[model samples]
Target chain A: MNLLEDTWKLEFHSGIPVYKQIIHHVQAAVAAGRLVDGDQLPTIRALHQQLNVNPNTVAKAYRELQHLGVLSAEHGSGCYIAPGAAEKSDGLSAREKKAKLTDLCARFAAEARSHGISFDDLVAQLKRQHPA
Target chain B: MNLLEDTWKLEFHSGIPVYKQIIHHVQAAVAAGRLVDGDQLPTIRALHQQLNVNPNTVAKAYRELQHLGVLSAEHGSGCYIAPGAAEKSDGLSAREKKAKLTDLCARFAAEARSHGISFDDLVAQLKRQHPA
Candidate 1:
């Protein structure tokens, strides 16, 4: 397969959003040995033109990919499929767990405040339990 | 205490990034009974104007907030603090666990393929273990 080919094979009827389809497409490409490290993806504008979607939608997809560290853009240039992304051994679980824990701690903090417990007091208890 | 105030009290010395600082500011407002649901936050453009930062930087902050379900924008109408955001109990842990499990499965799938085991066979083993 030509490494620089922009053949997305975009699908829109999977009940998943287009951005997600884009994400999965990239993941599938990586898995199937199509796209490799340091591949260049079309810019958001180019993708929007090719996919015939709103710029915001393409931007959203790009944003999601960027958030996942799958792509990076150079200002005045274009987005590139990030190198070494293939070797990333699936840390999504760890990130998801940490986000959940942040939310849990926020909730716990609110609850503790409602119960008139000092932040320090609650922190002490949590530290005692987890010992971090 | 003003609802529309853009007084971020920006703290650059904190270990967290500026965008995260913005997220925490909004979260703290909701938690501390300052900003309520449905409040209108400054637009990314306006925020960039106020903070003297690049539009991309402001957009990045807004995008992060939007990802967290904390903000929504109306075209031609600036971004608004998403309604009912305050009552959102932290589901960080659940999200984290699910992300972790997704990564685990992906790794397993890669390994299974490497070992010449069918995807169905590996999935069957996982289903047997989790029964989910």
Candidate 2:
């Protein structure tokens, strides 16, 4: 899995389409700087082989992203994060930022709670997993 | 989504199947005590309606879980968590426990990092979202 989707695997089940999942992965990666502006994406062939999906699926995702200005394509080279894409992806106002933070916290707490992890252990786990 | 999958929505991406996700959701919930032995599960019809999947898919998931002895069905009443289901779900040996903890931590860190949330904020958010 990419850094954007370490926990989220790419198994298209029922609701979300494969292309949408791919789009979300790239957007999340870009928003976090795992993928910065101008970073080249895997070629269509490489990505389909890596993900074991139809080539058309990857192509469709790239095309949608390009239209969204999250990605730009070179004539021969693979697609790359568009300039200012980070800003576009995050277009978060202050309120949205607060909401996003709250959502993240809720998700983190849920994961810890589901695993029977305590509050102190949860904090400690964060420190261990994400050292400054 | 249930408490077990508040953040991990039912939308299957590309690697996991719908039925498997349901099974995992129940196991996680049972291991965490959100679901306990004898707790009633939604009828297949209720679940299929709630999750908007085919009824057969829900039946298949429940059948598999029953086969694993994680759930039991009554003639008139709905399905319920089987006896000792918790133990079966968490059969995590000591080493497995440590591994699960580490995996949870890594996933937590990845989610926080992707959201650009600071470690301090993550901890604070947990406390706020999950008060003792």
Candidate 3:
């Protein structure tokens, strides 16, 4: 509760939409092991109150997460992280994995190019992330 | 605009929206210098006819580009790549550049984590891109 609140501080001037920010935060939380399978998320109404954002915004974020297979919503039981959703490494066929990797690389390249980051600079940074 | 058509072959089954595909292509074109400042983009109607996508989708992409300061639209004319927009490296203040870099890195890290790409593997692949 409080931890969730602390982790998901909304920056009003970040120029990113509230729902998008929520989506990113939730994904980051799941990636970091802060949220896990079968863990229930705050209801849209509760989150809206906590964040002072529109209920529809929270609903939108939840719907998007559900669509991505990261969250599963029950009619009356609320939302839980989908089973085995955190580990995308599992269940993917070799060809599927390769396709995902290629797609990610293309997206990374596009983003890097847009930010004016040269391939050399990107490689340098990647190297820095893993020394020796 | 055959070149544009060729460069922007849409994949309806890619699980990405048409407008997002359009946005990515436009950004890539700008990064590659294929579209420069003052280059007029196809009109919404023209693009709709060419791509056979909804005109609203093309308009949405153009509006997003304009919001990003990547494209400028005239009332009676079509969209143009915004002057000095391609080179984000030029006008960014030191703080802004650092912030942007940090944001990009955070996004990259999140994406990598989701894809189960370890730092070591990412670094290895990056090194491959830069021999010697």
Candidate 4:
């Protein structure tokens, strides 16, 4: 069974492009350890048939993943998760890391605040979600 | 001088649509108390000129805000923040609130974990950013 198809859902009306959504889901799955190194991704045609989305959209997403070094594609053999793909921090410099971290923090802050969640509440929730 | 024009930037290359981006910024500004009730938003034309985006994009954002009760349109007088808009919890059921909060938390978790930040590190960063 293709667990990726069963687990990852596509929101067609999310205003984000379909290809970007696919990229995000694949990265997220990799990060969550749901998809591991050497895991084979559904081919463009199969995914399109399952998703009822354009084949080009799946192809674009796969191309982007390949470009990001998250996936390795063989001309006729389908795509596989690249080794060490979960880390995904290979080429980032210290400054770039800091910048990315800052951006992520800002986004979290904005989202939490927008939802009327206090900073204390956010901290509590995070602690509860990932108890040490 | 419109502070919003100076502060709110649109990232055209981002896969998120322009209208959604505008709605998010407006909501974020209100949530941060930067844009309060009765605050006048830029005219659709003015903002379009300033951002060099299509006027319809600005109009669509304003319309969505109005639909959400975050902004009010007064025909020829431009848009203004709706009364008590900051506490935009008017129409949500308790179950809806929980769902939304869970979604936000999941997104934050995914982002932080994907960046290789430990949950402890994320909590520390949140504390540093929002010291209480």
- Candidate lDDT (C-alpha), each: 0.56, 0.71, 0.70, 0.73
- Every model's DockQ: 0.03, 0.22, 0.12, 0.14
Residues B100-129, candidate 2: write the lDDT tens digits: 778877887776666554455556556657
Highest-scoring model, DockQ:
2
| TM-score per candidate | 0.34, 0.36, 0.41, 0.42
**CAPRI grade of model 1:** incorrect
After TM-score superposition, what is the CA distance of residue B103 in candidate 4 from its true location, in Å? Answer: 13
Where in model 3 is the C-alpha error above 4 Å? A1-132, B1-5, B89-132
lDDT over C-alpha atoms for residue A19 of model 3: 86
**lDDT (tens digit, per residue) of candidate 1 on B20-107:** 5566566556545566677777777776777676788777777877876777877888777787766552323323423443444345
| Backbone clash total, candidate 2 | 8
Candidate 3 lDDT at B51 equals 90
True contacts kept of 4: 0.20
Q: Which tens-of-lDDT digit does each residue in B22-108 have in candidate 4?
A: 886776677656778898989999888888999999999899889889999999787999999978743444345456767777788
